[model samples]
Target: MRPAGKQPLQSLYFDYPLFEFRQPPELHGGDMQHPVVIAGAGPVGLTAALALAQQGVASVVVEKKDTVNDGSRAICVSRHSFETLQQLGAVAAFLDKALGWTRGRCYYRDQLIHRLEMPHSEDERFLPMYNIQQQYIEQFLIDKTADYPDLIELRWQSEVSELKNSADGVSLGINTPEGSYSLRGNYLLAADGARSTVRELLGLRLQGDNLPGNYVIADVRMAHEFPTERRSFFESSGNPDATVLVHRQPDNIWRVDWQILPGDDPDDAVRENNVRERVAAILAMIGHEGEWELEWWSIYTANTLCLDNYRHGRVLFIGDSGHIVPIFGVRGLNNGIADAVNAAWKLACVLKRLAPASLLDSYSPERRGATIDVLRNAGKSSRFMTPPTRGYALMRKAVLELALTQEFTRPFADPRQVQPYNYEDSPLTTPEAGAGEFTSGPAPGAPLHNCRLDEDDYLLDHIGHSFTVLYFSIEARPSSELAALFAQLYQLDPACCILRITGAADQVNEDDVLVDASGRISRAYDAIAGTVYLVRPDRYVAGRWKSANPEEILAALRRALGGSKP
Candidate 1:
């Protein structure tokens, strides 16, 4: 493990997972059927595979590329993504290698205009964000799949050339290093990427707008002490009339994104000579006298495109295949991770007969709702970063100009970081009135709070596939009533992991009781004695009540399972 602030072994591309086809049974004779098949081996696809594996469902992940991602794209991993990674059992490696930060700064020309701090305190398990290269993330996820070798089968250099979906399942024609083969699966995950073959074969189209502006991202290696904070500059003398972003990565590598004019030829913009010149000029502008080497460079346009729907029959789209948003607020990868978690749990439930197959239908609405939310949020940052029209550019200019002087205008210059998306309106969550005696924390459909259960334990570590009925009361342990409540809960879903939290710690028994040592959980959840919460597998607040009512809890639990009221 690379210790925090330690450099990694310098490398260009991540190591590949080689899968040799030596008399594979699926291809040797008849078509082999699997429970789930993932079409891409990127972070999202691999995460989906691992998620299914954790639920005891087997999956086959197919990847055209032989190795992890090339270069360092998507450098920012949001805290929400880290939570999902922890649930998939790949977060230990990530925490060791990732650069953690909680603050971001915005500058106009040379003056510091605004500073935004993400919510982080001693009570939280992880920080607001971590800056790790995309390749490293993919490598960590790949390492995790090895732990569940029987449950996860990773195929390298295997591309889905064609796919046909039906009422039963999806039929896929895979082209591999060995030869073309065929396989059938009960469900297919189209995490193939932005240029998805599954999407094309299915005759689906992404509908949205693309900004006219483009960004040249140059990853350079150098040693420096830049406090690991997100920094953005607009109309700076170093890179005059352009917007530049700087983020620090591990191994002494740094990623700088320079927004270029719309007229700049994409071909010439990515040239090494041009990229180096721009990078060098910006480095000098920032007063970095240290020597540096250009490692890699790429160009990307600010796009806010997504499918009209994320689900079609047995095929579910995830990651860039389903949506594309600006990278400024770090929503792209985070939202993709959410897609994997959301789909993984629901898919596993249906495949295991724990929930009705109709549960899968709710995925599109919930995730599509999330995608729309991302588009709406990222659209603001996209327009702010790359103003599409002259009027918008002038607006930004005025905002940046006033930000230098007026304190009130400084908020306008701040890049509103990604928010934990709420599914209050999702079909899966039980909607209810927020009116209650103590209404704090998140209501139904909101992302659950992550608090420190102990020095190394987290409250989220206990949330999973079953409905976790958090009986937050003043009881020292499971009361008789609570035992009966869980009896019904276990009958409804045996996967549930129950925990009791209370205001008293010393009075509680050690088994099945977690004392809110710091009262953060109770304060965060606005819980009093008898207050209870039903958290879904993805750790979203499925339903909460001021008091425990077995009938009401069971009714909401059934609703979360996509079944009618009992």
Candidate 2:
């Protein structure tokens, strides 16, 4: 089936659009600089550009490739990612074509041993995971960039050859199809892949361990009736002594990842006949005897590598350029998207002079902390999926064998799906006044839980791309003094949204307020009269309070913005 928002120009599961590369003006005239220059046009870079545009920040995105990604790489999209996409105005395009699923099953020796169900409720707008090709993800983000033509300039087939950075700005030597040109920007964000050219130019190296185990991910087309759910197999008859993962994608394509044993040659694993034999064994073992054709396949190794620092001078590294995590937990693309959002918002605030330049310093710490956390958890999953030593292998085998009969051992088979990182230790997070009092709501540095307002409307729909204040008003309208306080906060930052949640629909007629008629949102946020939550631009709660004190809220906002002068 063709993806939404684009016409099919090719005959495969999706169309690959070849973007045209235009001549640069620097070839014939003087150099031109941009507010921000982004390297690479992959999903991460494009998402950064879109996120920047959401804040009215302009950027120039350069890509070495002329078309989208070649294969169905990085097919899993997390709900937190969907929330970021919604802020960038590109979620509808994704929801149109991506397959959503919440359930996963694990099998050991062809026997079902464990099941995984990510947290989901009717109040949530998106599912736990969505399966779609990376090409579609890139194309959808590219399509959204068209809406901000004046802000985003996409340069295709233009690669970064030389780079120089200083405290003031960054300069790059860009090589295009026509010739070479020099460009400048106040800041450079590197969203390029793991083998980033910018990272190399900056002489930064990724520091981490590359866990042992080689897996070949292959996508095949067939008319299988299996539902869209993640399924993992351990020590199955298909491969005898390997771990395999199966995921159903759109357009009737199935993605199968089977491990290659230690003595197996990585090159020979992708041979047509070898792949066919292994795939046939896997399909037969899973009771799928239908005819299938191989579409694409690639070799992947589990690694947890990242840079010590994400920022160098005026150049900031994001996505894979900043860190690389194990693929076992589907943290690659999702983590990159998170990096893009985090960097874009902070950079935008700095550029707009809304916050001090020190705000950018927090990027490396927050994101690097997240990377370290992923490495820790994914290291466990990687070792579990592919035991490195003989003793570990034996332990894993015993766990699987015992898991078939013991209920407690069954949890050992769980993959421990990826979850959003809490930035409680972040410098921007303000300690709550009565933090110990609230037991149910999102704490400082945690993401707000979405609440369903109606069948179609959700809490996230009301969130904006700025600091938001969720004020709970018990009366029909806030006191005159509290109303004056809201006006004062608005005067501090016009972009700031002070959304008053009233208990009754007729309490307020202002468009800036939300009516919690059903009290679902109140319960979700654990709100009472005068309770206030200060939400950052990235949707993470910065601070919350039981009483809506004006000075405390102002201090929290300033602290969240790097203590900038009001």
Candidate 3:
């Protein structure tokens, strides 16, 4: 195990910066109090800090390590994750550095049997997936936090020794390079990874089963002409009776994984020479004749473990600390990103006194429900990729065999990719209107569809860090009642936004209105005259109506805020 110290870890293709750890004011008895103190300076923790900062909340992030993680772990980022990053003002660097792709190919016995194409449209701002190393992910998030120095304080080599929870707040005993000190936070966010110290100290345990089969994941640097697409091989000559997955990443670093046969010695699977031989065979099978050097390697098994609840009084768990999803659908990091965003926004509302404390009670249900959904889909992929029983193994073989001759069976090879989890059942979501009220659009608790408004503008681009209302008007000018409703909305919450969409191009001169000259945005949202959609701060639709009344809109807003008393 790596020791807890300020030593900068080495990476083959990435430079590691030695972050300086300064003594905290608490060590000098200065009695510093943080609004939110985040544990574990990983991608999720840093993302939570950034998301909080975006909501005008301050946080202090503590880490036991000195720099970014060593290996290229969690290399896949989904488009939904990029949208979260966009809200935090940190998507530019990622968009510039990550390799985006949407195509995947699956082969049975070296013969291509299935091709997977993820959903992509011209209205979308990002592709389906982006391949970037985790080290770069952490570093990019850290760099983005620099824009909010007052809001985010990163402390390296600081480890939590003890935690005390109270109704008022949380007291954390932190050990640093200098010495041990204590800090108080109104709330603590545990973004720690699989082996969570907070969960242990709190005497909480994750509940679920760890699936079977171990796979050796390795990264190699080589000059290859492969495009950035996923390739899966089943029963290949390189690794018979097992599955092999390959992905092309930036910096000429390719990630490869092959399952370890049941009878094979798991220890020998990762041995330097054995890994080299296996990688060489796989490369040859893929028709690559170029030389490659091993960078890093590790072993992992599929697991669907998760905590029953994410909130523990003052400490709210996010990321792997709360749940660990299988990597088959690339839901691990992407789901963590979603958790951070969801919790951060609700925490911000509570801290700013915009909503009651009960507002946070909905976090566990929404995110944990999403985790459960991931487990269901990922379990299927896991069983197919690495069968735990002979029955499952035979079933997989039969499916592969049938897929070779039967075109209709090819769909069985599909690795169901991750999708944005809908919070339709969330307590915070206002009940939607009757099903037939609207023909097409995002239902309550669904994420807003990104629609193109012009050559350079999209619907989500106009969103700010607050509750949003989209009002579709048939008249070139809003009626007096609608104007009064807008006034009432501002009076209720000045931070709330009322975006008026009109077909009249000349009416676009208004600051709060968007001109649907092409009607594409309207069509995408299924917006008709007098249609109203209320969106939460996290971009999920809170409620929608065919014709909205001021009282109904205010009531829905209050309900979305956990039925807070106005």
- lDDT score at residue 521, model 3, on the 0-100 scale: 71
Which sections of candidate 3 miss by over 4 Å? 1-8, 474-480, 491-493, 564-566
**Root-mean-square deviation of Cα positions for candidate 1 versus the true structure, in angstroms:** 3.7
The alpha-carbon deviation from the true structure for residue 78 of candidate 2, after best TM-score superposition, in angstroms, is 0.4
Off by over 4 Å in 2: 1-11, 475-480, 507-509, 564-566
Q: Any idea what lDDT model 3 has?
A: 0.89
- Per residue, candidate 2 scores C-alpha lDDT tens digits across 343-451 of 8988988898888889888888998998999999999999999899998899999989999988888877788777898989999998877647787889999998889
lDDT of 3 at 535: 93
| Model 1 misplacement above 4 A | 1-23, 474-481, 504-511
Residue-level lDDT of model 1, residues 1-566, one tens digit each, is: 12123234335434434456443456676777899999998889988998889888999888888777777888889888888888777899999999999998888887899998888877678889999998888888888999998999988878888888999988898887678888789999999898999999999999998867799888888987789999888888778778999999999999889998877788887877788789888898777999987777778888989998899999999989989888778888888888998899899889988789888888988888887888887788888888898999999999889888889878776777787788888777776645665568778999888877676977887666556788887765467876787888787778887778877868555656777877878888887778888888888888888777777788888888888745
Clashes of 1: 0
**Model 3 clashes, total count:** 0
- lDDT score, candidate 1, position 490: 85
lDDT of 2 at 151: 95
Top lDDT model: 3
Measured on C-alpha atoms, candidate 1 has an lDDT of 0.83
